[model samples]
Target: MKYPDLFPFSWFKGFRPESNDNLETKSPLRQLADIISSSVDQIDATFKDRGQKYPNLDAPFDPTTPAEATALSPEVIHCSSLIVAACAHLSATVNIPTKLLFDVGGGFHLSAALGVIIEGNVVEILHDHPSGLGVYDISAKNGMEPTRLARLLRLLATHHVFIETSPNVFKNNKLSSMLDTHKSFDTIQSKPEDKYVGTSGISALFAHTCDEVMKGSAFLTETLTDPDIGASGAVEDCPLAVAFKFKKSFWEWLEEPRNEYRMNRFMLAMEGSAKLEPSDAILRGYQWGNLPPQSLVVDVGGSLGHIVREIRNAYPGLKYVVQDRPAVIESARQIWEKAIPSISDGSVVLQVHDFLKPQPILDARIFLCRGVIHDYSYSVAKLILRNLRDAATENTELLIIDTITPYACLDDNQARVGYGIMGTETLPPPTPLLANLGKANAVPYILDSQVLVVLNGEERTIGSFTELLKDSGWKITRVFTISGSSGKQILAAPV
Candidate 1:
């Protein structure tokens, strides 16, 4: 199969690949690591300036009394914590090249192949075999070579995907067991009726990410540099479109008859992501119980009504209408009717509606859009918000549930100066760390890049979100951070 073109530097005239000798000096991670190392002195100086004895850098700083609090500025403690966190980030970022190199060199293929192997009951056979299956035995069972299989298994084991017990012998571990097709049997009870190739949630998600998303990611630079598509926010100009040389948007491309299997896998991956994501955040983050009796909540772009169903179970007083494309609505109708018959009785309505178009439902109490806006560009996101804004009354609340990409150094006093952007509040860290939680917010940053590469979209900063909402004639009322989860809930109302 033809892969998308790898990131080409030809478009960037002056761009030269950094050599190993200069990589450290040129690395942002190295700069961060240096900052962390130098911060220790600043911590000591702050203590001394405050007429307090400096705490040993090697010792843990635990302030128990008022005197201790006075001795150490909250800044010092925060900086110390940040140092620890930054070190970990530096380590991880430095090692990223190894992982990237592997991915470039058939890592995705290896992972998918492994998923297939585990899906095929090869792991179960090995488990049952007791002595552990050798390369020859496993290869014979799967119709592959002993040497190649051993090498692949060993490479995977290096990353803890499986256990290579005593060199050639291999066995499934906790991590690898997740790929087992029967893993869901205990929870699902019955076999999955879906005809998707890989039924395992993780397997499906992994396969989809590696097989589809990775292909698009490879040509991200090429997509950006193409004169016809440079910096275009249109979905048709997205990296995925450019990579596949498709004239249609990502959704339209997926709708093609030739991409049936790909579509199924993509849907399965979404389902899988839903399972892994903190869906309960919606339940805990919002006050659904506070809504008036029989208030209608429209779930915009809610695939298969999964989120609505979960919310409904918690707050049954509120009625729900799950809106999506016709096919998704049909699938949702089938799934919900079979699982929740009452959903068919108008209590939980499945509406076949495109979010880009004006919302047909009027006067909805709540318009909940989760994991939707990040799939579009700023222009498209504005269009979506505007569509909702038109249908929404003054009382209608627009709850956006998605990742709120945090800005770096928001807590720094200098950084906040002259930054009059709304929703850019400086969150106080527990002294001595960088204000934006530093490495803790790494996933959101990575996700921001993923959205950019895949959809010509973004995981917006609070400021960006505020700007987008303001432009669409809506004002953010409040932002709620879901505890123990990366998802955030932004509540807005029409201006």
Candidate 2:
């Protein structure tokens, strides 16, 4: 059976069409509507040209499929971002003030509900019964209350996560199935601790985000209000501690024996984050292949050496030293030993080191710090940078792979500073849209808050990064904003 078009005209039926006049003549609301309509048309055309249909919401998500691959094209991604931003803007503009505020306030219920179903393996259980499972049966399998499970599933269905096939039966849909661990229901029941291992990691990511991040966020107001810890940039006093009443830092807390599974899940969640980006996003950043043969590259705080494994495959001539905490280094060693034949060789060395300490390798060609610096305060980030700077030779380069946040409002300075050594310019959104692409470029802002709550850290703006780098005796040499990458690649050299 043929599914309807991805963005049917009826979807935009309520959006008013402006006259065929130029954009300046149209109102802001009309401009947003136009963006939505035009983006939808562009997305539709791209899929048709590719001879692929858009996946419907009713089906389960399969990223490996051709239809899903088509959605990854840069053109499709840009148009999708436009539609998401415009729709959100349009809704906020027209929504009733009281109703909008209440909806926003009650948003925690959604995350709470998701946390419940994910823990209960509701999606996995529902996956077996494609025809839809009765709430009573689902509860019997998952052990949630029948009535409560039905209510939670209903709420998710209203959000398009699942579908209510009948009065009390529910089935997994595209959005809901994304959280599936892909393990057998029996396997999950037998060993719940191993549910995240050898899985897609999406479920672990959701669990971490909803359970820990959501809990920490609950105390954001209180953390900000406390006179002693509120303005303290120390990691030990982060909002996570405020919520959990833990005396140790977040990392130290994760290392406790009781929290081993939590820590493992967190690592898997970090790896799962790569699923958000293109497969070769790491290679897209720095010019690894350009280096001379046998050039030494150090990966600081590189958990499991996953990023380096990709880079090593692409640039086989380069040698690597992957550094992290002891437990993480041991895990990386096991993984590398199995995956690479030359694991015993000195080509790829797994080192147990902390970024807080002084660096070890003094003559490396490049120091790769992916997803590391963002988890610290300015002072701590400076120390990490300074350590690398201290160990660097005159020719050494430092590649910081992390998000360089853009301001929400217009910033002429950012518009002028192009990314990458070739000076590739950033495209500004059309007039009436936000300068930072609104929700399109919202992750950095969202993560900024998340890191603040959890680690007393933040996702840095380009300006913040520049200042931090300069203070640590490094200069921003170039930056590469790779397509589908979670962050920009900021390449620096010792000043």
Candidate 3:
């Protein structure tokens, strides 16, 4: 009856119905409040234990500080998730239905305001003005109307993004500073096309999400109601196609010459997505060091070979072949040839290969697909998996690294038969809380809608993954949950 030592302490003990936990007898509201209070206590103690103070929201963000990494530690992350989930659930429990609906429906305005500020370089403009900047001064610098800019900024300030100092004056806070590209306002103004070229990619992510995904999502109902496209499951029939009137799939549309800026922004936005997860997330599950020396590990659809480079850096003996579209392979060649010696010595090979076709590297000891499958519909995902399966030998292992969503309610069946070993258990949240941990596990659900709007894809549950792999001639062997990452590593072998 003992669970795996996944957490620091046995806090999860007695949460089940069969256990002697007293939380089950309390009112749901009280239980949620207790969850928040206890989680905050844990977070407070941890910060004090490390001789660090909890970060202040009023101050600008400083990622260079060692406390930034400490904030992302697994234990802290879990506690934070519990607090967020409990607080949100409690708020919903007490709020009026009409008011809750209004807030949920009006959420797009936040995205619109964020896009305006990021595009206007407001964060960069406010970077030097630590004290505050008046609306007129900001308008003079950015050319936006003073009153209109004030209204937009006030909206964001209300949401705790920026901070309003005095009347008509605003300053960047920690939440808003994340959008700062650190570029000079002049450079951003002069080279509009290159604003996101050398930055942290956060601004680019904001631009793409607010501009493209937000626009496309507006036609979600229309796309769903249309019989011809709704049931087709074709990427060309997605909501983006309906909103933009484009016949091509999302990737093909990005390739058009007129959309070069958008294409570049999309690429950088993906890099920003990777930054959202832990840097060592990819190394958590699989035993890369155990592979034979010089074993070829082919990274399929590996844009810029970032994942392969990380693996090669950690486990140098394993050779790699990073395959992608021609343009991506050329980009990898250009970026890596100068920076990485592995490319020069032929230890890492960059080849252009489409996953829709049969894989070329038949001798691969491991076929690694990271964050590639979720960008396609089930039909397209099947094509990618079947291709890998066709090329995989008896000894070749396939590692799929992506999010595995959990259900909201309790599940006895999945807990019993899901992809886990005898000793390790995937712990559920305590009673009176959502089984999936609700808002704490909100990223994958947000990404589900994200893929639907952008590429007609989806984040899958464990059952969905099992069905897909079974249909593609692979059998699941093990699943390893990565610490501080929404994504899990699912290892399978050719059936």
Candidate 4:
């Protein structure tokens, strides 16, 4: 049985997925594994930092009251952090003049915040522990003032992360949705009827647009909403990349902190989402025939061309063309030319084309898009799909690789950043919401709501994607699974 896409989704209880190991259903186990991994120490230190006596190992995680289980209730703290992150997102919404200054300031604050969150102390521990040793103990020994810690924890709470025993208690109902990553994804894909895919978890919904997509909207939502924050631009500047508005002094402090780990974590967190959908996995096993011969794949916005390069090498006769924004394509062209002479010669064409506009190549048999189309307003993706459809012929194959939210009508209810709203020409209309967004498919509608709040765009579900294709003039052939439970390699054709 598939979980239905229901609003105010409540998978908290009485929820089931068609497949027992379905990632959405199975992730809690994985999270438990990760929590138990090294984080147990972090949890231990957290209790120490909070001055709570460690619970006996055999003690049940059950705490009579939320405050009673500090060590056992890391999840509660995580739930609280969701609020802090949500509110903290406002740091980016300032006008370029401010954004220009704020990111540098914000970055430092965030780094400090992160250190405090992870290690329970904000001293030079992260760097001093060159071996990454037990610096948590060292920091604790050195002495962290109580008043400062309280203030810092309070700041963290503003981001929506609340500490269990802290004097501060957050009241935001919505913050719970975004705190636990697994819960957040379920909420994003949940429809009005599917409690499993309910709206309670906001993390995935927040991730789609609110948290990482853009600076403005994320920051503005928090800033405008905050009572103490000084004047920020009116709400209109929320999503724009007006990063130059902040002070130069802020930028000066910000330049050095842009490290590799930070860049990769934040970047991949936003783009290569945790939920690996079947569509993405399916792209892995396909027979490309021969490579370095014909351009077998066009990876639009394919970052680093890692996937495309793999496909190219796997089938030496087939060549690859990585079409992305100017920066990405140009960078790829130069990097490949230097690394692999063959790719730089002529086999790979790193062209610049916006998916929201007309697709540059229509002749390729399989036109593949993975983790690309979900980055914009729905209206724009349709334009891109419409272009692809207009570019296709009877034999031309359209391979759209992305996460497909569990089909709402079916009893399946798993949701992870997958929106079926690409206008893929089939699967449309389960229900509607809001006067402006109109009726959308189960997963797409939820993703759309997220886009409205966070980054001003969304992820779609299979049904919405089908509808979108139809709207843009295409037809769905099959929605088949690949390796990952969350992803799918969607097959469609131009009508």
Candidate 1 yields a Cα-based lDDT of 0.68
Give lDDT per model, in order: 0.68, 0.82, 0.82, 0.46
TM-score to native of every candidate shown: 0.71, 0.92, 0.92, 0.48
Candidate 3 lDDT over residue span 1-495, tens digit each:
111112221133222233436865788898888888887888888899999988789998887676666676666766777777888889889999899899899999988988888888899899989999999999999999999899999999998999999999999999998888888898889988999987778889989998989999999999999988886668898899899999988988999998999999999988876776667777877989889999999999898999998899899898999999898899899999888855778899999998989998888899999998888888889989999999888899999888777777766766665545321245567656677777666767888898998889889887788889899988888888765555778888999
What lDDT is reached at residue 179 by model 3?
87
Question: TM-score of the candidate numbered 4?
Answer: 0.48
Residue-by-residue lDDT tens digits, candidate 1, 21-75: 6654555766565547656666666667766765332222233543356433435
Ranking by TM-score: 3, 2, 1, 4
Q: How would you encode candidate 4's per-residue C-alpha lDDT over 1-495 as one tens digit per residue? A: 111222212111211223434445544434333323333455556667777765432222223433354522424333222222222232223346675576445744543553443333222222233233232243354355545655664565555444223243222122221233332222323431222132222223233233233344345455445564323322222233223233322212123354333333334443334332322343454445532356556777676676676666656667667787665677677778787788746677778887657777767777887765655445667777888787776766677766555333422222322333232222221111111112112344554444443333456666667788789887777665432233456777778
**Total clashing residue pairs per candidate?**
9, 1, 0, 86
Q: How far in Å is the alpha carbon of 493 misplaced in model 3?
A: 0.6
**Residue 308 alpha-carbon offset, candidate 3, angstroms:** 1.4
